[model samples]
Target chain A: MSTVAGSHFWGPVFALWQRDMIRFLRQKNRIIGALGAPLVFWVLIGSGVGPGFRLPGWPADMTYLAYFFPGTVVLILLFTAVFSTISVIEDRREGFLQGVLVAPVAPEAIVLGKLLGGTTLAVGQALLFCLAAPLAGVPLDAAVLARLLPALFVVGFALTGLGFLVAWPLESTQVFPAIMNVLIMPLWLLSGALFPAAADSWMRYAVAVNPVAYGTAAVRRAFYGDGASMGLVPGYGPALAVSVVFAAVMFALSVWMVRRRRGTV
Target chain B: MTVYPVETDRLRRVFGARVALDDVSFAVREGEVFGLLGPNGGGKTTLFRILSTMLAPSGGAARICSHDVEREAPAVRSCLGVVFQSPSLDPHLTVAENLRYGGNLYGLRGAPLEARMRETAEALRVADRWSERVKTLSGGLQRRVEIAKSLLPRPRVLLMDEPSTGLDPVARVDLWSIIGQLRAESAMTVVLTTHLMDEAARCDRAAILHQGKLLACDTPEALCGMIGADVLTLTGREPDRLAGRVQAEFGWAASVHDGAVRVEVPRAHEQVARIVEAFPGEILAVTAGRPTLEDVFVRLTGERLGEPFFEKAGGRRKRR
Candidate 1:
């Protein structure tokens, strides 16, 4: 009987994921916005900031554009992850969330299904942003691409989990956009997504505490062949470990928050 | 006889200082259409939400098919189907897809899920338009699809919240007919909430709720009988003065409320002459009719049925 119940759990998960994917495909404009915003940042902001700064600890002769490209990839993850929480609020208003909440599946599975669906869309956006890096004069190799996949997955999971955590307490969509502006922008700026982390010790300490900073570091390691330029502290191992742990913790918190809120309502 | 499909004991749900549901308890028998009749914010929706396992009660307990909602939520959820007041379908998906998703949630797959989908579509009269996107469908058709989705799992019990709110009159009749047929065929227990007296009259049994408390529970005929006599409503310029005169002269039970004068009259046609003779002002209109569920509700709560007290022009009943 337990085995039968376990088998039933995957049915709803697949259905939810498929439904989201189909919706994403149907809304071409949303897909474009998700993928296009990072490219604009790469061209407009990267050029404006490129000439004025030098990446710390990078080998000589490396272009500033090279340093900024990885940051742009992480930026895609940051923006998409934060905005995805709005979908949760939308779901709530539309009563779709209540439908799923009443399902027989565990709350954890429901959270996981939503996270996976949102992360898949974010990953697609991030990959589209990654494809433009070489055209902007950043070099890419097979080794880099190989490492980038896992890094992107970790980043996606972390951002999606964070989105779920933030969406839990929200009752309406009107408050979410304002909350995202207040929360995500500072996290992105402090995470070396636009500049090197070692510019100031205080800033470096702040980035060390930021979960997305680990994701940035991991992405930088995947893209540049060296992770030292991404942050003051080098090494993809610690960054990957931190991101994975953060994702797990946030995902658990999101599940618990949903359950707790369900109890109250 | 089969056991009760749904039973709750002193179910209470509190949000902060407000009590959404206050010690509410009721049971629904198999194959019976049970109505939770109440005005808006009267805890009918809250009770439905708790029974569907979407919201937990702060106190008391509920069971579906003998499975406790809190302890065995999974089993309860599986045993029951819910059609929320708000439309829950994805506007992006087709009718078929929506039904398929609902079926999948109940552990249905393969031929069984497909067969259920087909059966529900036919039963709901939406089989011809299964491929149409829900957004393109009319409100009535969309509601039919929602009903079809709820029926996909072949649940032992079905819970609906104001299912006819957005439906047209003809559509509502058709939907109720479908519900009656479905209950007759499957013997599934149905618990629905509505403020429509005509809809409530169709139910096998109904519980009238006002201010999060059960005012009365019984069949429609029994409820109307509790009011004793037919209702005689007289509207005129000086309703209060006229009501006082009528009450004094005839020594009849009469009350002036909600802009109308209600009198318990055995023979309303005969009483009309006495009323016209006793009152000084000209009567604008006089309505004599059989006491309905609305009268029963108004008699118990001292408020108009269906119209929420919170929405009255002046501050009326204080929120508990």
Candidate 2:
């Protein structure tokens, strides 16, 4: 059977991916750290902005708490994604990844497995964050749940792939906090997660080029339903298309990095 | 089938201006316990990495079962099982879980994978520790589980990098006995790298590496036979001065090494008493014994195995 031979490729991918999942579940601090901080940020900053404050493109009735809800969800996903991918640096430093690198699996399978593992963690955290939507005055109905989950998954995959690329060449996790400060914080800030982008603001231009912007916009569209969006963000069709393309490209980049010259590692 | 389970043809690897492996070529016959013996930074790890398909050679090629390590990595990987110097098992995972994961990487699953895991665990004497997390196990026990995990795939060849590293003497003995038992039971072809002279002596055949070059490759006894009949070791604080005096006065070529003066002679027992009598208080202790693997390394490379080269600052100490 072709499947029998093909399992050589996918089998290792599944094993590596499953190993990450098991490690994530076993570590209690990871779960708390991944979910706890974003929840705190959402509550503190959301209420601090007050309900009456409105952006140029926000719906009149939407509170600052409601506006910050989807951004906090994206924050959870980013934290979990970074946390999961950081294990790659650990794997290399501790010699675990060398075992996988020597296996019969293709490099593409390795990249896909790690991306999926990180996506699984990110999406899990995102789901937990989603439960608090009502606190932000957003609905938790089936219609919202259905659209929000898929959009989060796509965003998770893209973000995790991006994280994998960043983490692959790094030999230590000590530099991650600095990297997160310089790269990750800016990515979320410009993605229209904290504030709505206006047509004339420079942020609108930055949002247009940011993949996370499309991801956050997709979630916002899902949260508000048809005709409820600020009209400042890209349409649902374009956001989803751009995000999927971003994910595919980031995945391909990760695969290339792994398959690069043998000496770099 | 290839005559050699492992073979390399002029394999070379370079890190910028430094060459890690330089024109190293050798072969390990099927079912043989082969050792790559070298000091730290002597290119054993580079060669191991190339054979295990982790690092591509900068020039020439290495093959496992006639498949090039670089061009046919998957095929080469399927035949080789590698146990690294550092711990590779996830500390959070149980022995059983680690074995299961290893089997899955080789495409084994379900009952067959479980059976192999149990078989290997029982053989390595880690079956009782299967449910314990790896972090809870001692270094020796973790290494046993690591060996068990690699065996789950039933690879034709096993390559271990510094297998006895960080093990107590008792644990080191236990590890070697396990390797002997595994080879006898399964006819496994085992290749291991080590810096310990005693460890290299246990191999059926061994290769000596120094500064990225192959010094010699032969059976342990054969390599030792390259040295003279006996080795006389003199331990003292001023070994370099003592060695120079021994060479100048006694006309014997003595070398200072590892805080000791070593001289290879035809009859060390006869020479040791004369040396002690001649030097008096200059020599702290003197011992004479048959030649071993370290003697062979010193004979070939003019330096003892595993000694730090830069620490030979005896010349400067005297001037000061």
Candidate 3:
């Protein structure tokens, strides 16, 4: 019944993606919570740590503000992903998702549409953060923008897919916000974002196991360019590989969750 | 390979230890209005979910338009339109926006999608409310938009779950009229589940369900015919005692409905006088009329249907 090739897949995905983008642009509170709060945190934490902040293996010349800059970008992506995927719970309660579930689209189409929507919003917010990288001594040119945007997309897609996985089967926003805070908050703290993956401590193993940490390492590598080596995963290639794997796993899990419909939609 | 629009063979579903649907089986003819009729917790919802391809049967099979609902869901989906018990519109989006999104989800786009949207909206009578946000519309208006959304794909079978749950009296009348219009105009099989007896009465045929079992299936008139030609009701202080006395006095199986002794009689008007005359002072009031679908239900199962009736039917197929 489809006119264009692959429209059966892309059509629904586009509808869901456009829906989230329109909602994000129209709601000032969503934009503020996703973008504004992270910018404020970047300023406060980056300044509070000051030039006095230095790790053993890192350069003493690098200020903590420059050190925490990538963390702020990751934080922005997380907040926007959370903001966008919260609607999944709302959609379940409101019955919109049920309508989509009964449609002629595949489960992968539903997962992709929802994940891509959140990824779009999260990356959009993080792009706003990239404009201020110059304040933290990070250069901001077309080449930097080109490299940084895709890196933000990778981090955002992984985070948003994670959110969609958690949010799909949930019936309400009550426990979901708590899950984001209690469960995901720790993954962020260990993500090399705070203190360079803590060389020889128990935290080094914790950071090694966290999929989110690889994402932070990737954004760091992309933002700083060639030879930047203090990221938790060490190399850009390895970090990107791990982050891509995490993103794929999360996306796959969400699709499986949507398809496992023995009891409900 | 039966040529029915929809069919289920020995279908069953269990939620842990509780059986939501027993070995239920039925078939729907083309362009007919069929209803799954029962009270709350009667398993109609579970059956509706299976046929709509939203849930799998724990055992047996369901086919829609000759395609298996579970194994060939995508093929079945193209032939099906489903209206859920709950509202499915995005409140922030306008009616046109909701319909367009619905069309897109089914792979329709561009000029044909726009033409179909306009046609469906006009047919559902929501054309004037095209620009209004769904949240801003009245409940009845919102319901029209919902039906409009489902019809965009031109489905061959329309499955509705409690289609009139929240509608007011006037809106419900409009809703039934719309269903009637569709039946007269298109060759679409419409199946719905409802606890409302009047709604069941309106259907061309109905399947009476209770406690995961199919109690009876036939046209409403045929099902009602199971209760005699007329109903004879007598109310008094002691209804259970009166019911027993009725069975003894006349060989009719009398049932008590809401503290009234209800008996199905061949000639209710003739019997009502005979009953009052025989009972004398014990009969406070007497009334006679044709048996309704509710009367059929109460006769076959009993009102409030309580645990006593369920315990009896639990052991055997009540229809047999």
Query: What lDDT tens digits, residue by residue, belong to model 2 across residues A55-98?
Result: 66557888988988988888998899888999998888767788
* Stretches of candidate 3 exceeding 4 Å from the true structure: A1-7, A229-233, A262-265, B245-251, B277-284, B304-320
lDDT of 3 by residue, A93-169 (tens): 77898788788887888889899999988887788888888888876788777767777887899999889887877
Query: Which ranking of candidates, highest lDDT first?
Result: 2, 3, 1
User: Cα RMSD to native, each candidate?
Assistant: 2.8, 3.9, 3.9
Error of 3 at A109 (Å): 0.8
State the lDDT at B55 in candidate 3. 87
Each model's TM-score, in the order given? Answer: 0.93, 0.93, 0.93
Measured by DockQ, the strongest candidate is 3
Write model 1 residue lDDT over A1-265, tens digit each, in one string. Answer: 1223322467777877787788778877876676678777777886776565655566555566776787788778766766666678777776677777776766766777788888888888888777777776666778878988888888888888887788877777677768677987788788777776665568878988998888888888887666344337557778788989988898889878888876621
**Error at A147, model 3, angstroms:** 1.6
- Candidate 1 positional error at B232, Å: 2.1
Candidate 2 chain B has its poorest 10 consecutive residues by lDDT at: B311-320
- Tens digits of per-residue lDDT, candidate 3, B1-320, equal 54999999999999899898999999999999999998767898888888877888899999998888888887777788899888788887889889999998988889999999999999999999888888899888888888889889898999998899889999999999999999999999999998888999999999999888998999998998887579888999899999999999888888886788888778789877788888879999998998888787787666644344445446432210
Task: Point to the candidate with the largest lDDT.
Answer: 2
Better by lDDT, candidate 3 or 2: 2
Native contacts recovered, in order, as a fraction for each?
Answer: 0.57, 0.58, 0.62
**True lDDT of residue A139, candidate 3:** 67
